[model samples]
Target: MRRTTFIESYGATCKNWTWSWSFVNKTQRFVIFGAWQEDSHHIAGRHLILDEHWATRIPKGSTKARRQPGYPQAIEHLSRVAEEGYALFTFPIWQASVGKTGAGRDPSSIGRFEPRLTPKTLVHEGGMWWAQDLSVVALHSEPDVQDDLADVGAPELGRDEGHSKPTGPGHYFPRDRKVREDVLKKSGEKCERKGCSEQLRYKSFLDVHHILGIAKSDRVTNCVALCPNCHRDAHYSPNKDALNKQLHAYARKRPSN
Candidate 1:
């Protein structure tokens, strides 16, 4: 543990305050202990600062803010202070909102101290990171519950069972650009029709026809590249099964070279 100071600025008064002194180093075991202040301005934009050597345990929703070149210089300064070896603690204070009452205890009652553990609690309960934390905060203010009750005309949940009509020109997959590049490369840019040595120049004139005609059966062994003329002949020819057998026999007899 070591002592390192962090300064936070107050927008209203244009004055800065020395916020916390924390242990920041390469050590593995660390705990961030702090109290929440109801009226302190620094709470809204608060974060735990760490040097490169120290790993940070940021609660969800906190991100590393953008920094200037001098950020590394500031880290170096903190590392030097940490070399002295002292236990570190951080106290985060939230700046009260506009026209809000300032930080002080009420005159008639004793103040109770509580841990700010809602964010950590929701995370451990296997909830979605953003939505859970938001739900907790909304519940704290009670407005979310009130709003849900006030919305009487909201749509019923999960009742839609109607079938959707087909729209025009739906694609099973993309036909343009790079779709045929790998297919041509695998089939050697030549039509798979036997004894047909015509090189395929335009992929648009070619189609990847499945041997089984089932969309799910798209394995390489079950497909072949065909020119439009050969493709139409395969489907419309009077003896398609006999013609396919002849084509397969011809393709087997020809050498790949």
Candidate 2:
């Protein structure tokens, strides 16, 4: 099975995007293919793929700007094919290019605006400055495109089916100790129920509860710390305010130590 990948760049009203494909084999750099938008309505570039004994370059001329074959199309196609088990790798290319006027004015002339420069040359003239902003897409193909398709497709199925699970508590907890610690500290080691603050003193007494349940994992701000008593009351109490009253009662009983 061979591996394949697709990539593309889109041109904004004020900027063009470029795409390039490159890889290394035994210390040799090989550029497979590249594409870019030179203007608002055209994409042009070339790519070279090296075989075991030879190299093949595919020259892409300007094509009419169409919504179908642009970045959106490549993304959709690559995603769909990858879901079926294809091995594809798509990445962006950041290149250097000259900063020229949208109207293709002379590089040397500073009309109303001062010179805007990029890592790439706007004019290949001896002293012209260049700046970096160009990007491109590189697509790779193996001996058999079908093999590549299967490689990407299998993993995509697992992702789409929701079979992936996080190994830790909060999404932020596993990655950031500071955030977790800050949340625990700010919660005063107690349940956030309006009246249940008295029951919390140690970490063991508190549980971080998601107000809307686990199904809404994306809702991070909806979580709060709660002591076991308050946690249970929040769920089982006939009236939600009962937990608030309990917290208030707990506060009243505590000595002002």
Q: Give the TM-score of candidate 2.
A: 0.25
lDDT of 1 at 256: 42
Model 1: per-residue Cα lDDT over 30-107, one tens digit each:
222233344331122222233232222222254553322323433332323222221223334343343343222121
The local distance difference test score of each candidate is 0.33, 0.29
Report backbone clashes per prediction: 4, 43
Best by lDDT: 1
Off by over 4 Å in 1: 1-169, 174-182, 246-257
Candidate 1's TM-score:
0.28
Model 2 misplaced stretches (Cα beyond 4 Å)? 1-180, 218-220, 240-257
Q: Give per-residue CA lDDT, model 2, range 28-107, as digits (tens).
A: 21111121222421212221111111112222243332222223323332232222222222222222343432222221
